[model samples]
Target: EFLRNELEDSTPVIIMSTAGNESNVLNAFEMGAGDFVSKPVSPSELLVRVGKLLRQRAN
Candidate 1:
């Protein structure tokens, strides 16, 4: 799988999906995604999540 192959590269992925469709977010988490955001997404929330993920990566 792409994720497995890229895991060693320390790649981060963000997945977005409707509230009712949680599978995509779950899959992304299973694939080692750094974060997941659900829609209808708010600009402030999106910025916060992205900022958190970036800060995580920096540490």
Candidate 2:
């Protein structure tokens, strides 16, 4: 999060973690995360998320 703030760049950050608590997910977004996925992540889902964010970024 500190790095995200410091970099001042538009690159997306997607957090994948085993901790699926609502607070953690919300906090990540509050800190500028583009997306979050609880673990045992699916490759297909991850790809979809990346595609979505990328499409938004393109705009």
Instruction: List ranges where model 1 is wrong by over 4 Å.
Output: 1-8, 19-22
Give candidate 2's error at residue 37 in angstroms.
0.4
lDDT of 1 by residue, 1-59 (tens): 37656556665567777753667667777877778777788999988888888888899
Best by lDDT: 2
Give the distance in Å from residue 41's predicted Cα in candidate 1 to where it truly belongs. 0.4
Model 2, stretches more than 4 Å misplaced? none
Please list all clashing residue pairs in model 1, or write none if there are none: none
**Over the stretch 4-43, how does candidate 2's per-residue lDDT look in tens digits?**
7788777888989999799999999988899999999889
Could you report the Cα RMSD, in angstroms, for every candidate shown? 2.4, 0.9
Error of 2 at 14 (Å): 0.6
lDDT of each: 0.74, 0.90
